[model samples]
Target: MADYQQIFQVSRNQAIKDVKEGVFELSRSAVIFYPKEGSFDCVARPWLTEAGSRSARGIWEIEFNHKLLRYIYGLTNQFTTYSLRDCGSLRNPRTIRLYESLAQFKSSGLWVTTHAWLNDRFLLPESQQKNLAELKRSFLDPALKQINEKTPLLAKYSIDDSGKFLFSIIDKQNPV
Candidate 1:
């Protein structure tokens, strides 16, 4: 099994905190990615690239595979939705840009998806899902604490195992 080194403690915390703040509006059952204690996966790194390179982080994007999205949807009974540049349609890139990234996918700029991150995967079953209240009381808030307990700059990106589109988070400095 492969393993994604938990990046710097600060980045890890920031990533987790970002997830907590981003999902408050949604119901508690909403399932976001949780980095396992030790997993060789699409690990989260600060978006640190210039404008064009595929790996460049400057464009500010996070990625995940299709299976991840389905898993999250299964847990929450609602798929993650995006607001493209405030337009309110998932199809509109500009509207989707208006919103921030889910902390689970640590980048802070574009609402995005990518193929590279999907090669490895984790999944959940419909019957294995959690209720909204239980998620709120248990997983949700604790995610933030988990971040604070570790450090402050927690961030990451999301991707499904199929390398399909899932979702991402935006950098705090540049609000969408």
Candidate 2:
């Protein structure tokens, strides 16, 4: 698919590998925390059936899970939106995750959560999780810088009295 070339700007060979990995990785379970609300623990069987690939086409032919489709298509009203262009160009994977988490709180322009919560969602390196300074220096600082530069969201963050991250995500598209 040109999506690999156009959106991600990756080489054909890299695209094939990425397509293969992404399809297989969906079978792995994940625990995602919502910045605004609850969490998701998806521990079900394979979300996609067969999930074979074509190297030439750089595509995975698979049967998607109905639940996954419904949730993604907004039937569940439990989804958030982000700029695909911005996400595709983002360098760090953590930046994309941070962007999505902040996107959910876009209406309020704020999100306050503990580092433990972010660790759980980002699944960051154990060393980073244990050390707050390292977490900020290694993960938070870089991700926030990317988010501010690449996305329409102007984000600023600080550690509150409770040692939780207080993020202010403001949409640059709409001026105050």
lDDT (tens digit, per residue) of candidate 2 on 1-176: 67767788888777777777777787564334344544644344446655676666566788766656655566447767665775677877788888889988978988999988998999989888899989989988988888888788888899988797899988888846
Best by the TM-score measure = 2
Across residues 1-176, which tens digit of lDDT does each residue of candidate 1 receive? 00111322235445444444433322222234456666743453322122122222312233334445555457564443422222212222221222223433443322354332211221212222334344334433444334323322233334457644444343444545
lDDT (0 to 1) per candidate: 0.34, 0.78
Highest lDDT: which candidate? 2
The clash numbers for all candidates, in the given order, read 41, 0
